[model samples]
Target: MTALPETTAKKLGLVIDLDTCVGCHACVVACKGWNTENYGAPLSDQSAYGAAPKGTFLNRVHAYEVQPDTGAAQTVHFPKSCLHCEDAPCVTVCPTGASYKRVEDGIVLVNEDDCIGCGLCAWACPYGARELDKAAGVMKKCTLCVDRIYNENLPEEDREPACVRTCPAGARHFGDLGDPGSAVSQLVIEREGVDLMPELGTKPVNKYLPPRPKDVLDEIDVLSPFLAPVAEESKGLAGWLDRVLEKI
Candidate 1:
């Protein structure tokens, strides 16, 4: 069993705004594209055109229609991936020590070379973040785009995770949450961000900003305009035209 570091130097993670995510799935696509080409072994698809199709993806977006207490029902787009928890159960459960959390950045990663393709890490993750790549014969999850974030060859602006960069709605943010002065930490404090199932004691690094109440529109009667008379009588030259038309 692998033991987690007592503390990480920095908690690098994401702050996802539930209210602003548009459910466009841009992040999902970006994640899949970047990971397949740049990261470890390429993500695979099993019988993509067959009746049962399966594919490996690092990120996924789920939408839910929720009714708030004071407003109309609204759809919330939730993006889910590995949280890089402080007490990640997946790390502890790995028999081969393939899964480990980085003490420098607090990012949980799996060493594919050391992986035995055991499903224990997937079973241990509470957020359902781990997926077994059938083609590669290894368990895979979001690395927070470790390769891209640290690649100095890329532009400074492009150094962040691909999902954060491609999010059209600007709902995803990446930063060091451990620093109180960081923008992500400030955003979480202002938005009252909540953890995903805090009761489980995972202490997930990723935070989700709750969706704000939507404005309710007043009900309108569609037939009201047609039901009312346009005018009591046709007046002036219009009345004379009306009389002539009636005679005709």
Candidate 2:
């Protein structure tokens, strides 16, 4: 079994803004592409064009229609991945010590060489972040774009995770969450960011900003003015045309 680090040098994680996510799935595609090409073994898909297509992906988005106490329901697009919990059950439950957390940045990663293609880590993960690559016979998961972030060859602006970089709506943010003064941490404090499941005691580094309350305009149709008739009673040329139509 693997043991978690007593304290990581930094808690590198993501801050997801639920209010801004547009359910575009761009982040999902970016993550898939980056992980497949740069990180580890290529992501495998079985019967992709056929029924019940299955593929391994590090990130995924789920949309939910939430009904507020008083207004119309709203759709919330939730993008989820590995939270890199401080007390990760998946790491501790790994019989082969393949899953481990980095002490430098607190990123939970699976050593594919040590992995025996066992689904124990997946079962232990509460967020369902880990997936088994059928073709490589190894466990795959989100490494928070570890390679890209640390690569000196890439541009300074491109150092973040691919998902964060490709998000059109700017819903995703990546930084050292351990620092209270970091931009991501400040955003969390301002937006009252919440953990996935606090009761589970996972201490996940990732935080989600709750969707803001939307304005309810059910009392009146604001477009009624433009939709109203321009003239209830016509005169002159308009009156002649109306009369002719009525006569016909």
Top-TM-score structure, candidate number: 2
Cα-based lDDT for every prediction: 0.93, 0.93
Mind giving the per-residue lDDT tens digits that candidate 2 earns over 1-248? 38899999999999999999999999999999999888778889999999899999999999999986876789999999999999999999898999999999999998888999889999998898999998999999999999989999999999999999999999999999999999999999999999998989999999999998786656777788779697789999989999999999
Regions of candidate 2 where Cα sits further than 4 Å from its true position? 218-248
232: Cα error in model 1, Å: 17
Please provide the root mean square deviation of candidate 1 (C-alpha atoms, Å).
4.9
lDDT of candidate 1 at residue 56, scale 0 to 100: 92
Root-mean-square deviation of candidate 2: 4.7
